[model samples]
Target: MSATDWIHSFDRFDGRKGIKPGLERMEAMLLLLGQPHRDLRFVHVAGTNGKGSTCAFLASVLEQAGYRVGLYTSPYLSAFGDRMRIGGCNITDDALDALVDRVKPVVEEVAATVHGRPTEFEVITLLSILFYAQERVDFVVWETGLGGRLDATNVVTPLLSLITNVGRDHEAILGQGIERIAVEKAGIIKPGVPVLTTAKGVALDVIERTAREQGAPCYAADRDFSAKRTAYGLDGQSFDWRGIGDHHVALRIRLLGPHQIDNAALALAACVQLRRMGVAITGEAMQAGLKSAAWPGRLEIVSQSPLTLLDGAHNPEGAAALAAALKELLPNRRLIFVIGILADKAIPDVLAPLTELAAHVIVTRPDMDRAAQTSDVADAVRTLAPTTPVETMDRVSSALYRATVLAMEQRGAVICTGSLYMISEARAVLVP
Candidate 1:
C-alpha cells in the first residue's frame, strides 16, 4: 500500500472514537523493533495547551545552536507527515514510505499479541522514534499524544521533562480534575531527570509532589522562574526571563499572548537546564531561537486586510487564554469570529469566554470525524452571549467568507478559532 493510504488506514483502528491509554502494545512494539529509542537523548514535553509551542521553541533553540533536533508533535496542523520533523522540516514521502514498509509487519505482529492491536498514535509514536534514531538527530523533543502516563511517547526516558501547565481537558479519558490531569502529565518525569513546569495552584502541588517522589529536580514557575512581559502586540511579544539562571534582558517570541510568555520562559528554563546537562547552547542562539520560532494555528495571523487571526482554542483553559489575550491586546474592539468545535468537548464552557468578545459569530464544523454540528455550536454561542449575533454555516470556507465580509463592513477584526482541526480547515480557505 502507498504510505499515504497506509496512514489513512489507521481510521479503522480508532479505538472507540478516542484514546486507549496503555503502554503494553507500545512495549511489545518496541521489543519487536529492537528498541530504537536506546542511545537517543530526549526532551519529553506534556501539557494541556502549550506543548506544541513549547516544543517549537525548544526545537528552534536547539537547531539554532546547531543541533539536529527532532520534534514529534500530535494532531498535525496540516499534513500527516507534519507529525515528525528534523531541523524543522517534515519527513519526505520517500523516507516515510520506507520507514512504514519496515514497520508494517511489526505493526501486524504487535496487533496479534495479547496486548492487542496497536492504535494509530501508538504506531506513529513508534515510527517517530525510529525515524529519529535512523536519522541520528541530536535530541528529540517529544510531545505526548494524550495524557502522559500511558502515552506511547512516554516509553523513553528524557534528559528533562516539562509540563507547560495543566487544566481540565480530555476529562473523559484523563479523569475529571485538574490535579488528575496534572498527575497524568507529570508521569513523563523520569528518575533523576530534572522537571520544569509553568503549572500553578493545585496542579503545581501535584507536579511538585510527583517530581519529589520521583527524585527529580523540580523547577516550578513563579517559584523557581518568573517572566514579566516587556511589550506585546499582534505581531509578537517581548518578555524578561528571570529565574533558574542569569536573567535574560528581553526574550522576544512570535507566538503571541501573555500565556506564550510563560511558554517561552519554560522553554528558556529548559535551555538553561540543558546547558547544565552538557548541551552546548549559547545566549545568542537562545535569543535568536525564541525570536524566530513559529507554531502554526496558535494566534496565527493569516491575513491583514481585516486583520484576521486564527487560534486553536477548543478547551476551557485555552479559550480563556485566547480571550484574555484579545482583551489585553484589543480592549474595546469586538471581533467577528468564525468558530468550529469537536462534538465531545465541554461545548458551553469552551464557547463562554470567546463568545463574550464576538460582535458577530458564524459557527461552522470542521471536516473531522467528531465535529460538533454548526447549529449546536450556534446554540451554545446564543446561550453564552445573548447580545452577540450568531449564525450557523455547515462549511468553514463559507463561514470564514461571511465573517471576513462582516468584519470589513463593521471595521472590526476577524478571529477564526475553536480547535486545531478548525484552524486547519480555515487555513485552506484563508491562507491561500
Candidate 2:
C-alpha cells in the first residue's frame, strides 16, 4: 500500500475512542514481530499532562549527550511522521511506507484472531518500535498515548519511568478521581525500575505506594529535586534547581510558564538517574538540552503585535496554568481567548478558569469527530461569566481571526487554546 493509504487507514480506530487500554493485543503483535521493542533501551513517560514536555526534554538531553535517541509521542502536533523520530528527525515517508508494508500482513493476521483489530495507537506503537530497533537507537523516549498501565507503549521495561504530575483528565476510561488517575499513570512503574514524579498530595501518595508495591525506587519531585524560579518573562524562565546532583543556578528554559520549570525539574532528575545508570549525560549536555528543548502549542507566542499565544489547555489544571502564565507575563492586560475542546474533557471545569481571566471568548470546534460543539462552549461561558461577550464560529481559523481582530482593537492579547489538535490548525494560520 502507498504511504498515504497507510496513514489514512489508521482513522478506522476513531482516534482515542477505539482505545482498548489492555496489553493483550499489543503483546501479541510484539510477539509475532519477534519483540523488536526488546532490543531498545527506553525511558517511558506517563501522566495526564506535561508528559510530552518531559519526553521532549529527556530526548533532547540524550541526543545532546551524543546518543541516537528515538522519540515516540502520540497525537502529532502537525504531521503523521511526527509520532516517531530518531535523533530529532521524523521517520521518512519511504521508510514508513516500507515498514507498514512489512507489518500489514502481521496486523491483518492479528486482526483475524480473537483479539480482533488492533487500535490505531497500537499499530503506530508497533511501527515506532520496529523502526527504532532497525535504526539501532541507543535510547527511546516513549510517551504513553493514553493511561499508563494498559497503554501500548507500556509493554516495554524502560530504563526509567516518569509520571509528570497526574491531573483529572480522561475521566471516562482512566477514572474521574485524582487517586484513580494516579494509579493508572503509576502503572508504568516496573519492578526494580527507577520512577520519578512531580505529583503531590493524594496522587503522590498513590504513585508512591504503587512504586513501593512494585519494588521500584521512587524519586519525588519536590522532596528529592526541585526548581525555584529566579526570573521569568515572555522570553522564558531561569530557575535554580536543587537535589539533582550539583545544583544548577539560573538554568534557562524557553518553554514558558512556571509549570514548565516543574517539568524541566522532572527531566533533569531523570537525567541524574540516567547518569547513575552509566548513560554518560554530562552537565554541559543537560544545560544545552534544557535551553534548546522545544515543545510547541504550550504557551507558544506566534505574533508580537497583539501578542497571540497558543496553548493546549483542554482540562481544568491546564487552563489554570495558562491563566497564571497570562497573568504573570502580561498583567493588567485584557485577554481575548479562542478555544475549542474535545467532547471527552470536563468542559465546564476547563472553561471556568478562563472566564475570570478573559475579556471575551470566541468558541469554535476543531476539525475532529470528538470536538465539543461550539454552542456548548458558548453556553459554558454564559454560565461562568454572564457579562462576557461570546462569539461562535463554525471554523477554527475563522474563530482565531475574530479573536485577533478583537485583541487588536482592545490593545490586548489573544490566546488560542482548549485542544492540541485545534491549536495545530490555529498555528498553521498564525505561524505559516
Candidate 3:
C-alpha cells in the first residue's frame, strides 16, 4: 500500500479502539508475531510525567555510547513517524507503510479470533518491536503509553526499568490516590530486574513494596542516586548527578525545567544499571548524551521577540513544575498565557499555577474531541484567579494571535500550555 493509503487505513484502525487497558490482546498479538518483544532488549520507562524526557536522554546516551538504539515514545507532537526512531532519526514514511502492511494480516486474523482486536497502541507497539528486531538494534528505549502494568509496552522484560515519578493522571483508569497509581506504575517492575525511580513519599513506598515482592532491586532516586542543580536559565541547565559508581559534576542538559534535573538523574541511573547488566556505556558518552538531549513541547521556546513558549502541563504535578520554572526563570516579568486542556484533566489544579504567572489568560480548545470546553476552562480561571484578565478564543490560532498581541504590548512572555494537544498545534503554527 502507498504511504497515504496506509495512513488512511491506520487512521481508521486507530478510530476503532479506545483505551482497552490490558495485556491479553497484546500478548496474543505478540505471540502471533513470534514474540519479538522477548528477543529484543529494552530500557523500559513508565510514569505520569518525565517518561518522554527520560527516554530521550537514555536513547541519546545509548546512541552516543556507539550502540544501535531504538527509541519508541507515544503521542507524537507533529508526525506519527516521530513515535518510532533509531539513533535520533525518525522512521521513514516508506518504512512505516511497510510495517503496517506486514502487521495488517496478523491484526485481521487476531480480530477474527476469540482474543478480540488489539488497540492502536498495541499495534504500534508490536510494529515497533518488529522493526527494532529487524533492524538488529542493540537496545530499545521504550516509553509506556499510560499506567505501566497494563500498558501495551509492558510486554517487554527490559534490561532496566525506570519510573521517573508517579502522579495522579488517568485517574479513571488507574484509580485514585498516589498509592493506587503507584501500584499500576510499578506493574512494569520485572522479577530480578533492577528498577530505578525518582518517586518519593507514599508513591515511593508502594513502588518499593512492589519491587520487593517481585525480587527486583529498586534504586530510589534520592537514596540511591540524585542530581543537584548547579546552574539554570532559559538557555539550559547544569547539574551534578551522583550515580552508581560514577559522579559527574556540572553535567549540562539543553532541556529547561527544574524537574528535568531529576529526569537526567534517572537517565543516568538507568545507564548505570545498564552497565551492570553488561551493556557498554562510557562516561564520555553519558556526558555527551546529556549535553545533546532535548524534547519538544515541554517548556520549549518557539518564538524569541514576543517570547512565546509551549509546555504540556496537562496535570497538577506538571503544572507545579512549569510554575516553578517560570518563577525561577522569568521572575518579576510580565507573563501572558494561552491555555487549552482536555475535558478529563483537573481544570482548577492545572489553571492555578498558570494563573499565578499569567497577567492575562486566553482560554481555547485544542482540535481534539476530548478537549475541555473553552467556557469550562474560563469559569475555572475566574474561580482560581479572580482578578486576572481573561479572554476566550474558540480557535487555537485566534488564541495565539491574541496572546501574541498582549505579550508584545506588555513586553512579556506568552506561554501556551495546559495540554499536549494544544502544544502540538501551537508548535506547528509558531515554529513552522
**CA lDDT scores, all candidates in order:** 0.89, 0.89, 0.88
Clashing pairs in 1: none
**TM-scores, in order shown?**
0.97, 0.97, 0.96
Model 2 error, position 388 (Å): 0.8
lDDT of 1: 0.89
**Candidate 2 lDDT score at position 239:** 91
**Deviation (Å) of 424 in candidate 3:** 0.8
Under the 3 Å rule for N, CA and C atoms, how many clashes does model 2 have? Answer: 0
Tens-digit per-residue lDDT, 88-168, candidate 3? 888998787788888888888887888677766777888888889989899999999999999989888988889987998
**Candidate 3 displacement at residue 421 in angstroms:** 1.0
List clashing residue pairs in candidate 3: none
RMSD per model, one decimal = 1.3, 1.7, 2.0
Q: Top model by TM-score, which number?
A: 1
Model 2 clash pairs are none
Candidate 3, residue 148: how far the Cα is off, in Å = 0.7
Q: How do the candidates rank by TM-score, highest first?
A: 1, 2, 3
Better of 1 and 3 by lDDT: 1
lDDT tens digits, residue span 1-432, model 1: 788677667633355656666898888888888988986999999999999999999999999999999999988877887889999899999999999999999989877878777777887888889999999999999999888998888899999999988989889888889988888998999999999999989988998899999999999888788899989988899888887555655788998898899899999999989998889999999999999999999988998888899999989999999999999888877699998999989989999888888899999999877899888888888888888898999989998889889988988899998979989888878876
